[model samples]
Target chain A: MDRKKNISMAVIKRLPKYHRYLMELLKNDVDRISSKELSEKIGFTASQIRQDLNCFGDFGQQGYGYNVKELYNQISAILGLQKDYNYVIIGAGNLGQALANYTRFDKLGFNLKGIFDANPKLVGIRIRDIEIADIDEMENFLKSNPVDIGMLCVPQTSAQKVCDILVNGGVKGIWNFAPIDLTAPEDVIIENVHLSESLLTLVYLLNEGK
Target chain B: MDRKKNISMAVIKRLPKYHRYLMELLKNDVDRISSKELSEKIGFTASQIRQDLNCFGDFGQQGYGYNVKELYNQISAILGLQKDYNYVIIGAGNLGQALANYTRFDKLGFNLKGIFDANPKLVGIRIRDIEIADIDEMENFLKSNPVDIGMLCVPQTSAQKVCDILVNGGVKGIWNFAPIDLTAPEDVIIENVHLSESLLTLVYLLNEGK
Candidate 1:
């Protein structure tokens, strides 16, 4: 694989969309697809799709287009979906429990190692067959368990503190459900799934249509 | 407000981010901000921020920059946050319950009118003070209550069917949490918050860093 040193964030963001579309096609037994066909289905222009895919390596041929299975496999590898990543949810609240029970995580190779919370009443409770660990044991647990990602489902006030603990514990990635913005070192990657922000976007679009 | 006839989706996507940052500034008692200062905090370029803001209307002054409170209010109105939108959750699962209890929705102007489920066992249960209604009564509930948005937290198989009900019952927007890509008429808007896709993006980023 010819890895590009500096790929644009825009291209990186669109990769998952492309991967998802390809997965759907593969499920439908689509053996091959042209850029034009992909563009029609995925909403991105053919030229833009070609440029985005070319960032990694040439996966498409001129007349032959792309092999759906091979392309899907390549994208899966590129997305690191081929590897099983161990993750711990910092808060065993409603959102955290939802994520813990989310079946897709196992399908996508994200293994939920544990769920943790500060409340003693909630700790030791079982969610999706995993016992909620006490928050005090988080750092110790990280030392023993190889957790690649930390899912922050705590409140705004505790999010940053939890983030610091996660980073200090050698967690490389954070998927923050907290509303607040967290600052992390350059080495750590953070992706925020702000539910409110997404809802606001929908509201704006709905109003705009009117 | 001078609303542009054609606003790019990219620009529309950034509006919520700007609103979030401005809200933070307001909370911190920051009265004013320049485009450069806003860019530094929001990660968007100064020119890009200016261009995005300009799409709706000129909200900034030459040297005085912008009044944080005023800009925030303007953005709130532009994003339809000023109007209270009634929303109902289709599935009374963990994700749906989380959204119903999400405090930010009330703060932002999305009112949780009801939560519904097909399970007779789960129906009539109260989540966030809203009693879960039976899925059979969904059409009747929509008819009686003016619900602007339908939050789809159902499984992949039932997502499209629920979406159809929401649209046919006169819901304007559908905030889909289901993994499937749903199809709606041109008049109705749908925004998908695919959790697996988000996790895949994080995994890809974590791998890329290595």
Candidate 2:
């Protein structure tokens, strides 16, 4: 945790990429991995991987590289993937439903406790057997069934209001899909998933002939 | 184009964010903005904003700051948003449908040319007036109605195959939503949108008590 505070956000962002690669390696039954090998697979440079991992601790030996399974576990722990986290979707729109039905979350230990929406037409609909509750019921639902995270998929107009509801309802973190930038109290963590940003980045890259 | 080739990927990634903030300012009828003002609003440092903008050319005057509309247009051109690019979604699942129905793309000059699905039942279903075509017809469709980009929303198992088809069909860029690392030819730009990576980052922040 002390090491985490000292790490840069750039490095923190790459940890999950490392985790994903390590998971793939584990699935392939590879017990060992060199920085170069991992780098070739993930696109990040070998030196950058070493530097990022060193911020956490000396997980890799000088010559032995890294134990794939052990490193995977360590990275997972550092990423807070060891603990089971419950989350709820704030909007039952297309984005919200896609996220609710995203099968990977459950495999990653994130339990979808509920799915809520402001639209009367959407409320009560089941996405993967999880019923979409009314936005008005979010507070009560959160109180009775606490969740660590809230996935905000509401439109930009209603994002802040829905975010506020989640925060007040005791959600410690928010994964926002709305285009709007949101603000929250110091205690609440917010990670904005700007889909368009990725698309624009691709556009720039393509235009550059990369 | 020469300046773009020299710019770092990190800087390129933030271009869309700067564009977004500038758009917001424009919408509010704000005509002029300073790096300091933008920094405060967007969370990047004033110096960083200046540095980023300087990569393309001098857009900000020493004392006069920047013309909001002009700067926005400059950034948009740099992001290739100035040109109209047609894109086809290769998987008409929930994510694909959401992206196809995403109204913001058309505003950004990315026209939804088509949507395709391997599922026979899903094929021909209309999303936002654009019919979902059978994946088998993708090659034929791309031949007749060529698109600049292919948005891959298929499962991990089929991502690579779908991507190959897109490339063979002459698509220049790929915005992949599948949780797989896809490979493409040198001319084809690929941007993998790993949704779980963002979630894990949120989890890490939450557990760190941020």
Candidate 3:
């Protein structure tokens, strides 16, 4: 967990993207990969892939390249995905419900622990093995058995308030899709997942492509 | 837009992030800034900010600092935020509806044009002055009225189908909020806003902070 030594944040961010690309290769039964092949799959340069990978260890052999399964395992371990991450969704609307039922996460080592909503009617509702709990009781529940992360699905106005509550409720991390830039203390990190920004970037790329 | 500029994708990706930080400075009435100040505010090194801004032009003075308002306008124009970008949400579910009413877009010049959904019950319904249209009518609608960007908010099972429909409907860009990735041609940029990846990063940061 030493922040300075493990890898740069930039290198760490690319691991998941590379992992996704490598999983596609593995699915096609491709067992060996060169830095060039890894870079091509991810739109990064071969040297850049070598450099990013070298931060951890020598993933690719000189002539033999990389063993796909071995490389994938190393990446998963680096990303802390070797073990499951238990999480709770803070809203129960379509977005939250969709996240709770999302099958894509099962393969990625994420477990939906439970869902929390302020609505009384939605509380006591069940999804998979987890039941939706009232938001009022969250602090007490969290104190007893705290989850590793909280997925924010609340409205924009409620985003910061919910984040503050989540931090106080013993939640260590957040997956915020709320499109709000939360200011947390240096210790608590808030990464924004803005759908609008992504759309805007794609538009710029398309505009440039033409 | 020149692909041979040797610009790190990390820096390219941060353009929007940079824009957001600048907007924050403007909102707080900070009229002047420096590379060092901007670096501190945005959590980048001064050298990194100088290098990133060097790609476009020198917006800073020799000894004095950067004129915040001028630099903000320059960055905005470079990012293509000078004109309002009209974008449509392709699904009228809770996620899309919530996005249509979101306030974060005002600062970034995003105008939510309308919403489209496959459900008959949702069609013709109005939210925030934009009527929900049937997916079957999207092609004709796009031809008559063009939108610069399309956001895919449908279920994961139907994400690829909807993306294909949008591409065939003449959309050159897509922002996929669904868990699954959509396959688009190389020329057409498809940004995968992988919801879990953001969470994973936050979790890793929190663990390290501890």
Candidate 4:
């Protein structure tokens, strides 16, 4: 199984969708899928699917198409889902609690190690058996129990501060839900889910006719 | 203002980010910004910023640069933020509740008129004065209280069914939080925030070196 280097971010972003569709196919006991059939289910063009899958490796035969389980497993491996990732939520606000309770991430091998918030009232509260700890303990917690990812769900004002703590504590990936963008070092990866910008974009598209 | 038609989706997506940064600038009491300075702050190339802003109308002078407030207001108008958008959450689970509690959306004129849920316990619960009603009441609710956007936070199984109801009830836009890709009419815009896919992308990037 030879792999290709320098896969484009566009293709990397689409790999999860491919993984998801393939998983659905496997759930329904589908054995194999032609690129055309996969395209119809996944909404990408057949040629685009072929090109994207080819970026990782040669998965499909000319006429035989792709093996469902084989493709799913390969994409999963490509997505780094084969190993479990432990992460701690920095701010246990509504968004933080929502993410903590989102069971799908856990199923995808992402574990919620701890949750922290500055609010005194929220301290000691539990979400899915993980206790919400004091914000001051976060750096110490990270030093003792290192994590691969840091889920930043704090307010924009404090987001960068908490992010600095996370990065300084040696976390590599940040799944940020704050509306503001944070500056980070070269080695650390930051993925932002800017909900306001998303809502604004939706509104823009809704009124694009105007 | 001479507004251009058929702005590319790439430009549309970037408009929100520009709006965000300009808002920050206004909050900081910055009155003007040159394209080069704006580019450094916003992480886009100066030429790219000039091109994107030009898609709407002439706002900047060659050396005088852009009036921050003027540009911000223009982009807000372009994003349709000047008008209030009424929306309802289709499923008041963890994510739905979080959206309901999000004050930023309210500040941006996206009003939460209603929240619907299938769970009997959640049906009568209130988040910020808006009560969660039975999911069965959504169609009737939509008939009387028309909404601009339908936020789908339901499970994938019920997403399409609820989406169909929202569309049939006359929603023009959908902010879907459900993992599945929903099918809507050409006129009905759907913006999906697929958390699992986003998380997978982060994990994949984190493991890109492996």
lDDT of each: 0.89, 0.89, 0.76, 0.91
Higher-ranked by TM-score: 1 or 2: 2
Residues A69-120, model 2: lDDT tens digits: 9999999999988889999998888888889888899999989999988889
After TM-score superposition, what is the CA distance of residue B109 in candidate 4 from its true location, in Å?
1.4
Over the stretch B1-210, how does candidate 3's per-residue lDDT look in tens digits? 454256566666777767777777888999888888888878789888888888877768866778878888877776677787777888887668767766667557777877899999999898888789998888888877777678888887789988887787777678887756678877667877776566657655665533
- Write down the TM-score for model 2: 0.95
Query: What is the TM-score of each predicted model, taking all chains together?
Result: 0.94, 0.95, 0.76, 0.97
lDDT by residue (A58-164, candidate 4, tens digit) is 89899999999999998998888889999998888778888899888888898889999999999998889988999999999999997999998888999999999
- Ordered by TM-score, highest first, the candidates read 4, 2, 1, 3
In candidate 4, which residue pairs get closer than 3 Å at backbone N, Cα or C atoms, i.e. clash?
none
Query: Model 2, B1-210: lDDT tens per residue?
Result: 567777888898899999999999999999998888999999999999999998998898998889999999999988988789999998887888889888898899888988899999998788888888889989999889979999999999999999999999999899998888889888889998889998898898888843
| Per-model tally of clashing residue pairs | 0, 0, 0, 0
Candidate 4's error at B195, in angstroms? 0.3
Q: Select the stronger candidate by lDDT from 2 and 3.
A: 2
Give the runs in model 4 whose Cα sits over 4 Å from its true position: A1-4, B1-4
TM-score for chain A as predicted in candidate 3: 0.89
lDDT, residue A42, model 4: 95
Q: Per-prediction DockQ, in order?
A: 0.71, 0.76, 0.37, 0.77
Writing each residue's lDDT as its tens digit, candidate 1 over B1-210 gives: 447458898888888889999999998999999999999999989999888888888889999899999999999988988879999999988888888888888888778888999999899888877889899789888888899999999998899999999998999899999987789998888999988888888888898846
Q: Report the first chain's TM-score for all candidates.
A: 0.94, 0.95, 0.89, 0.96
Clash pairs, model 1 backbone: none
Candidate 2's docking class is: medium
